[model samples]
Target chain A: MKIKKNIPLIDQHDKNGFWGKFGGNFIPETLKKPVEDLTILFEKLRKDKKFIQERDYYFKNWLGSPTRFIKLENLTDHLDGAQIWTKVVSDLNGGAHKSLNATVHCLLAKRAGKKYIVGDTGAGYAGKMLSMAAKKFGLKCKIFMGAKDIKRQKPNCDAMRANNAEIVPVYTGSQTLVDAVSECMRYWVSNCDTTAMCVGSTVGPNIFVKICGWSTSQISKELLIQIKDEFGEIPKKLKLINCVGGGSSSFGFWNEFMHYNKKQVEFIGVEAGGPKNSKKHAAPLTYGSKIGVLHGAMQYVNQDAEGQIEETESISAGLDYPGVSPLHCFLKDTKRARYTAATDEEALNAYQLVTKFESLNPSLEPSHAFAEAIKIAPKLSKDTVLCINSCGDALKDRDILKKRLGK
Target chain B: MTVSPISLAFKKCKKEKRPALLTYTVAGDNTKKKSLEILNSISKYVDICELGFPHNTPIGDGGQIQTASYRAIKNGIKMKDIFQIVNKFKNRKNSKPLILMGYYNMICRYGENKFLNKCKQVGVNGLIVVDLPWPDNKKFAKKCKKKSVTFVQLLSPTTSKKRIKKIINDSHDMIYYISMLSTTGGKLKISPKKILENYNSIKKINKSKNIVIGFGITIKTINSLKKADGLVVGSAICNEISKSINNRQNPVTNVTNIVSLLKKRIS
Candidate 1:
């Protein structure tokens, strides 16, 4: 790792709201006016004092801000590599880092003076948090979930519905997260004036990239403070790793760190590798995919020769997306971060290991990170450090796994 | 940019003092032969013919068009099949301007240059990629221009004034103005007076002053859209095809008759 005394200045988004040619507003004329309006409004409201105070209130008071950053003694001892720490992201409401932005977006919609909110969820955390936050903020919530996801992540879907959200069952386009999100985007465009689209990831076009990035940056900011207090100072050989779907956690975890002058950390993003039985995987970055435009943002997309996005397969429904967030693409391309994948077997075994060893159940999404941690930690020196932002609870996969095992 | 066959049709319509009739149908909807025969019949009556290549997900589409796409996909309509349909339509009598309109991903999958070359080879005069909004890789449109195929853009009521000013002077002959926020078969709740007010404002900015309106347009609705340069019939015609197919009749005859009726109403 090249240790630079001067911190690498990471531009979250350029003047056109691009993360180095990764993000932009590439939508129809019907959506152009509203997206541009959102672009202008986000730039103004994100810096406003009242808007900042309002979202911060929800984060600290309701969503449980300042998640615990604890050095894992058990995992650290097992690997005997570096001092490993886990940023416990489930210490908040709705059980993940999803609440970080979901809460903020509810306040944003309230400030913009809209009534109805619509969004699609891959893992159900975003849907749950948005429904919960919108309910608390006195706003209407509607969620779109894929039919397959609705069956697998049924508990999460019921949770959102319990919060008085209208759960729309999407049976189109592979019946997965990608289809649900695409339908939601078209619905938003048709009803942009009356409804606000709550994005579940840091992907999407401009203005949205900025909005999601600013809200989730709190993860890195809190990690900075906790590390300073625990280690006395930041270490030179620290590796930051997290799993990427639409990359909310990784994007949030790395934002503030890039602003530091002494930038020597290696950031790695773990993508979902398919089950051992199948060659179909969702790791677009690892596969060296084509750079194409989808979801209004240009980034790495898992597509066929005819430019149609391919149907991705993964054990974890949340991680089974064909396109990655533009920020992750930009980061990987610039070598600011690296990316790898863990097979479904590896992640499943890692989840069981964490639950038994630490008596803690982690979601299948972040279980990929756990697998990477064990693999990377053993290769590093014991004096070095490894950190994982542990963000999901695997209760959703437990039932399916048990049924598969005939429990 | 080359003056496309579409532009020539518009010029002829301008002399006749009537709005040019633009008709649409999804290529390979049901079967290649059946859909091409429908296209052949539709071309004789309409000034501009838009042949849509079905996509897996049609975002701007309504229920009728989506069902049409599903039927086409079920009938095994691929990108190559769409061009094959156009090739057959190219030799028809009074075929008028043929525009290959569909989602951007289909063209991208076909390879932008490869797709444009295919369009040129099949005598496609223009293109209207539904999701490839302005500034979304103008590179594809530029490639189309190089092949002497006009890449038409959409300017809706929701389009910003800034964008209108930017695209009005482009060499494309006409712009598609989606009349409502609703999909193709959505109710005619769009106020004609409001559409004209917005249409005239958009026209005021354009040097060509060519604005064709579509979305929820039927024969009854054509008179309301008389102020526009041209009238586009998409879902209404697709509905006729669906109804004819449902009644165990040849959709080609039903669709062509509807096109003639729509052309009569506008003229």
Candidate 2:
């Protein structure tokens, strides 16, 4: 029940092992040796500062890092309740915190001699990002998406198609993110010899978290610099906030901040509160789950007693997963981080408020952050400035906004 | 002392100087009575019996076991019936080990403590769940230990030496090392030399626990594993049952053929 004590990051060369409950190599026996080899190689490469610098170079030059922190002056006034600030993450690539991890995965694949890749995606952003990187690297990419998602998230599907990544629409259970992940897992198990699964987020096994940890590191570094620059001093009691689905954005934002900013800063994660108190939400933090295994690692899952996956609900398709990253579960349990929820109505309101005020349309996922921030911001002193992770561009959700907001 | 099924099986294996033939049939393969017939026929020659509890999807399993699991389920083989078979088997064979093998979902539904209690009540001895690798740390293992039920560790060739050593050290009964790279009914490829070498090496590390080689093991494959303490013949026996049912032949004769052939090698 106690939080697993952290092994010194320096002494640990691989991130492909158990990270609290979140990280481990949950691959088939055939893939174990190769993935282990990849981990060993990646660990050594990651330690070399030059490799990191080169990776950062791509972020700065290609993917556009140091994403803007725009204060939502108008939205704060409109909410008439609490202040809301927008972190612009959508403009990073086509739209997301995905490009940061995608670019690094491609770079690592190139270094590790990985030529082909496969992935499971929920809303198609990560799939698009992976395809984008794969096309650039001249590698074959196959993305598995839920059949329902393929229909609903048409724009993301279009993006993946444009990148020439083969899209396999899975018609399995719930046709959401977790189903796509299961299909991807089966595919990887079958094709372990040639293809590597570019698992997104801090979920899956160690290989996944390590790949994601890079992005989290970048987010932290940027936030540190931005805090110093904007406020003329790093806010002493700032709370770092983001939405946790599979938790790459939150993990990316928190890894550096969690341990280093500990005692100084508190990390808050917002999960999708689908249909409010109904099984329809993806609130892995609150009610939607218990610790169970999915996609190779044991974590929290909204599953039946018989282990059948339950349908997950959320306003954000990306956060509409039945499972949360085990690391997040560990963090939640150990009280290292606090997890809360923002209902669909609240997230939408936050979305509309931010757009009306700041003229920047943020993804519904991040509005969960805005909603949580609204509550937390009021109690903050004038000296206290909280940083909200804006996640992806909400341009794709325009129709949703117009319908919901009567805009 | 209530001996763990694995330890008892190992003692029997050593005394007989033959590999224990462990047959895997879905609890109600064709019918519960028919499945019991196969089990009873094989019991005379086989040393241990592995009853595979069917699930909706057997990810690690191939065609034969999948078919058997499906057939068992088609005939209404609930988790409860698994213990019923074990109880019946106990009336027939007073000493031979009976092991239930499946995934964690089954345990989660049946309830860990409840499952262990049933195993003890039915005089079942051991369990080997595929999805559960960290068996030592799970509540199931602790309950099984408390109930004196042996928790068997399934090992593959790819299992690390550290893991193998830990499993050997942690295991209460015999080690069931899967011989092939694939699941049940997979084609056997390991040469006699390799099997002997692996058996010798594993035996060198842990002499107390019995080492049983399974998965893709045939009569010939089982013969090659003389260095192993026991042979767990699952897919081959299940495949034979499937063939007999499909081709309209005597399953008893096929079961007898495999059981007699394997018993000869170990003996």
Candidate 3:
């Protein structure tokens, strides 16, 4: 269903935490001041010229900015449709694009005079990256992880422990990323005096989504320049595809382009599709999802008939969440973007295919996008150019892959 | 103004020169019949009853209430079922003022009009939506006024005196003054002297002077909270219910006993 009014989220904040009826500050009264204070400080810092320069310096020198944009010649030829290019986020420090926002938010926390950084994570990559950032920034890091996630991503837990970050396992609700987020909110509410919640996704209250999305938009800025340098001019039909858990990468990757090329570009967001004939997929927006409030934002959620969130299933640990980012919720609502899904088997197959075709081991997170690209690329005309973001490197997922393949 | 049960309860407490016991528990906890029995018996001890609508994700709640919600949901309590439990409580011999307290998502999912219609049909006297406060959602508060369901607003230490009057102007029956800057069941970090200071500041504006303070009001804490019109005892009572459930005893008896004990001490 097309949204009755197609006002973009960034332009439509009536200031009561509304993002086109998708994002809101639906939180407890004790948290009201903290949310508003963060909104005020984040807006000031986002526009500060000195803060921007310092952040740019850290982006280049500390967290590995200007990651490469590469032409996937073999994959493009194999598909034989659109000219395919990829933004290699794997080259960034912490082995994923997650470090960008984590590092930036750590600076925000220090500027706010916060002594500790607290966050929630799904697949463990974000928590590890945030822990490393916290260690470097001279702050204490506390991560809330699901017991289920801790078991699946043991290597990430070890890395977080090595950085001296405390991991608090959540046992409530489904004991997945959704519960981790809820638990982290309770912790943040109790300790909002001395701590800043460096939320993992671009899905939180209004202030959180705004600050995180703007900071992470560096990817699209760099990708824009690289694409311009590759082709003499910006292409008319540039397709930007990225996999989404809570949609940090999709929000970051598509934000700048959507602003710069609103009518000129197509944004494609993919989610983890569980096995066939099962209620396991994590594609709430792609599938039929209702608008409800969870973890401080009103967005699309895979809730039961009685408005209770349901546990989602996926082979990829990162994408196994019931809710998506509110911006994606807005995009899906307003027809500003296309939403799709890829099954676990298909994502795994894409992981292997890309490993062989590009000699780059891709995480199952972005492999969902690659999986969809393979389907859509074969049908697109030759002049169209598609950009896929390799947001996660598959190095940490070796054990899961080995077990799934039974190799 | 029509005499709403919430206003009546506060009026009675003020005339009697004692704080009212406002007890809270989720409807349909364990079972529909048993929860109704507990609520009816609980009405005899407390001056007002806060009925919680059990939700899947109670983000503002601590562990004890979350566990109560889990049991209530497990017992097949829907939004509609909560009303059935409320009607059962209202139909009892000694019916107390009933306020439905819950997160906003469930009501937003139920839609505002449909939920208010259900509240009116079930004779719900007041509402304490833990998430929606006074600043932006006055439209919702207006709708509740049309239906005569008191849209209870919250005042925390974080709220300023200037903002407190505005919130009090929006409030109808009672102002839920959160005693600390934390979720329910957290220890009372603020001294009773400081909490009463904030509570009395609100009485300076609103004529009714009705305020119910909650969050860490134990048997020991109840003595110091008698200056207010009412005190909400939720987590302490829920903790007793959880203990009885774990010990395979009757949760209703345990809850009724603690509420009675707290009411006696406060009086």
Scored by lDDT, the top model is 3
lDDT of 1 by residue, B1-267 (tens): 456787889989989999889988888876888989887777777888898888765667777887787788778777887888888788776677888887776776667888888889989999998777777647777788889887888887777787777766563777888887876677777688888888888777764756798888888888878878898888898888889988999898888888888877877
Query: How should the candidates be ordered by TM-score, best one leading?
Result: 3, 1, 2
How is the predicted docking of candidate 1 categorized under the CAPRI scheme? medium
Could you give candidate 2's per-residue lDDT for residues A1-407 as a string of tens digits? 34323753212333335545444544444446556766787778888898889888888888788788766676555445333455677768668888888788788778777788888788678899999989988889999988877876778888899999999987655777877876676566455556777876667655676667665567777877776787787567767889989888887777665555455678899999886656577887777476666666667777666554568877678898878877787778778788988899999877766666677767888888888887777666655556788888776666666777776
CA shift of B41, model 1, Å:
2.1
Which stretches of candidate 1 lie above 4 Å from their native place? A1-17, A259-263, A405-407, B1-3, B70-76, B108-111, B135-143, B239-249
Q: lDDT score of model 2?
A: 0.73
lDDT of model 2, residue A227: 69
State the TM-score for model 1: 0.93
Query: What is the CAPRI rating of model 3's predicted complex?
Result: medium
Tell me the tens digit of each residue's lDDT in model 2 across B14-52.
Answer: 787666667677778877888777778777776788888
Tens digits of lDDT, candidate 3, A262-364: 4578999999888766777899888978888888788998888778888888888889888888888878877788899999999988888887789777788
Error of 3 at A399 (Å): 2.4
Residues B101-213, candidate 3: write the lDDT tens digits: 99888888898899999999988999998877667669999999999998889888778777787788777777888888777888988799998988888777875658889
Share of native interface contacts present in candidate 3: 0.60
Error of 1 at A1 (Å): 19
